[model samples]
Target: MALFLLICLVLTARLWSQDDPWDVASLRAIEDSATYAQQVGRADQIGFSLGQQPFIANVLIWDQEGTLLYPTSDGFTPIRYELTALRIKEIETSRASAERPFWAPFDHRATKLLTCLHEANICLIYRRAELEQELGLESDALAKVTEPDRTALLAVMSLAVVITGAALLWGLRPARPAPAAFELIADQFIARRGDLTVELTARDVAILDVLMKRDGAVVTKDDLYNVGWGRDFMPNSRALDQHMINLRQKLDPDKSRPHLIHTVRGIGYRLEV
Candidate 1:
């Protein structure tokens, strides 16, 4: 289940990364509106129309020579702001070359708008922030995902988190319960719990016998070492630890808490059962 959600999340993020065509359509709408305004000589009114749009911070038109045409010197300084520059060069070039009806030159402002929109001579600029805010993007300056797409992406991420948590919980589930009764049959070198019985080596029997005799009392490692293997043949420090581990595994294979033997840090061991 977690793997499935992970795959879904990947696909969702991939799909959301694609550009929405509506952004292009919206820009075209603005272009078309500008074209109409220039044709009818309402060029000065273009700013008013643009200002009405929630996404338009400002509009600027620059000629091929980099000279500011619209929003003349009296309106704004020529310093460029962070902008989305849309170069209509080739597009305008092809359209301008097409045949047209005979007419006189346009009004000064209309000519400026015409030159910006229909000649291969100008670049249109808009504030980048306006475009981002209008399109619901925070960082990626281009390509936008709609509100629904954003919500779906968030939901996919949430599901991925939930699936991961469930996996962890399953891994941390409780250990199996220990048996009801347990005893060490020293004579037979065996450890028994209910119906289960485990055979033990002679050394394991000697160590366990010592722990049981001092039940609920901490038995020093030195005493256990001497008892299990006479002082003349004492093994390495790690030998005793390894033997104890093996004994614990044989006695309670389930390895539940509140074990029969407890290590008293640096001191020694204690027998609880």
Candidate 2:
């Protein structure tokens, strides 16, 4: 899951980088051109220039005459000569407007080429060099920008998760004690009377502790099977029963009515608290 999230973040960054060139400013210019064309009820040409040396020009020609000018290998060729003349006039008008030096909405040089004859033909041109320059500036800006190391962050996050998981496992581990006294061991027996001192192995202590937890409650054979041999189907459980019997003999003086360990008729056994 962590790796998946990391990959997703990296992919998102890559996509954002790819789209960084056509940023908000570029889209705004296109929108403004569309709005102007709609209001004037005539075809409009919008041009944008980019970069320090401004080499490229991008032109958009909108014609209401329903004429389609196909672009050739070299450049666009309009079928209607009148539409071409109108585009040239528009570009010239834009250039004559001295009130604004840089093109409004975009830095590229913009001018009205010509006036439309039937208010149907509009021609626009854009220099490709300007777009390249803009892209170059955007690339440079991206390069100069600093970002956190994704690999390093992922490594740190993975380590944190592993550490947290380990801590949780440790906290959930069963409590145990080091070898102490015989009575301390006997105290682990399910049924306790104040007198006996019992010697038991580590396995024996574990079994006694499990039984003690459910004192006076019937403990099934399957429960003993799991606790003693981790539910190993291959391991015989006779030894476990023998250990219980031995523990009973040690704790109960009268073995007939075993005070420590008692057998249930059809079930398993119980520890009398």
Candidate 3:
């Protein structure tokens, strides 16, 4: 399950990286602006609309005969020459339509879109950034860019479903059944549930036997001492406690919370299962 999620994550990243960052919506917006500029004709309206779009760097207006009407200055001389050359070529060929917009390379950072208005008898030029900013507005731009990557979207959704399913399966899994019983065989203590066993000292075995016989009932300290030391060689309370500590540690290293042997406070200890 983990491996599948990892594979999906890697595949999703690859698909996302392969997606195109540019969208046609940006081009459509630019085309509409250029068409409107040519229809308005007034320099003020055209300039105002152009100024509103931060993506547009400059504009050029050309008459039907390919004469530069706007930007009287020689600043865009190279671009003007290219536009006229293309216009003249189109005119000579008589193949290109005047109603639709034409695309031409501007430079490394920008491109030029020429939209010719047949009724107005003039062509509107727009020098726009390669990545148009008008339509690239955070979430809206991301949605437009990723909408075409259906494969990547599907991979992400599948990963979410798999993770949810794994969590559900884990939560619904059956609990492990507790050990049925325990028995002492020589120096080894064994649980009936499985082959789980632990080696024990003679005193540890005797002390455990007494507790096991009483089951969950408390076995007193005197009883444990008699069984562990046989009265004649009985040790002090601290010694018996130290032996019990060692026994509990051997049974379960986490003596702070012993599962098999539980301390019964003041009295003695009891065996649970």
Candidate 4:
């Protein structure tokens, strides 16, 4: 069961990892270039292309004066601006002075974009005018798409737990009861007297064979222990007590007053016909 749970957890982690689609450094680089393009008032003139074929999308550029420009989608448009050089210098200064790496602040943004790509299969476009509206819709769609089937997975795990528990229970079942030693010997004696009948477990028959061979004498705890449990000496005396109890129950007409096998206090038991 533990092994099964471990396997399930490993599979789940692999599935989640496979589903994760995003490269942080790549996204950060794209964002940085986009920021530079926007600050230089050339966002409309500049276009970002992705993939092998270089598919382009129209982007709205903003100048330092907050002036918006819209570029034609036909081709690249050159925008003349004196602040472009100053913007580059400012970016260099910002990079040098920044306490953390340039990509650190945008980690969450990159992760969100990656998740969107994995679930919604949508391209993230940072349009100046429609940014808010597109972002809201994209985030909502991504949330809906990425939501895993937790309820079904939990049910399956619960079922597995129940099955494992049941299997362990079945495997650990106790041994079945065996006939008493005295009853087995008595049955053998009766069988020799023109009545062939003996119904006893192998363990009970072995004990009976040992006692009958001794000819009704008292069998010490050690003697019974060796023959019954195959031990050199008495190990657990309670085992002998239980076996004797089973023997009395099977042989004695009134179990409350055992007649066939008699117990000697603090010593052992004797079998008498």
Model 2 lDDT tens row, 1-273: 323433443444343333333232222233333333443322222111111112222333334444333222233232111224443333434433322111222211121111111122222332222333435544233221122234443232211112232233234334433212222344543333454455566666666667767633556677876776686555455776787778677665654332456564334565534
Judge candidate 4 against the unseen true structure and give its global Cα lDDT, from 0 to 1. Answer: 0.36
lDDT of 2: 0.37
Backbone steric clashes in candidate 2, count: 32
- Which pairs of residues collide in candidate 1? none
The parts of candidate 4 lying over 4 Å away from their true place are 1-198, 232-234, 253-258
Q: Which lDDT tens digits does candidate 4 get at residues 152-195?
A: 43332211112232233234333333323333444444311112
- Give the local distance difference test score of model 3: 0.46
List runs of model 1 lying over 4 Å from the truth. 1-179, 256-258
User: What is the TM-score of each predicted model, taking all chains together?
Assistant: 0.34, 0.28, 0.31, 0.27
Of 1 and 4, which scores higher on lDDT?
1
TM-score of predicted model 3?
0.31
Model 3 off-target regions past 4 Å?
1-181, 187-195, 254-258
Q: Write the per-residue lDDT of candidate 1 for residues 112-231, one digit (tens) a residue.
A: 111122222222333333445545655344322222234453443221112232233233334445434668898888887777788988988888888877644557789889998889
Alpha carbon lDDT at 96, candidate 1: 39
Give the top-scoring candidate (TM-score).
Answer: 1
* Cand. 4 TM to true fold: 0.27
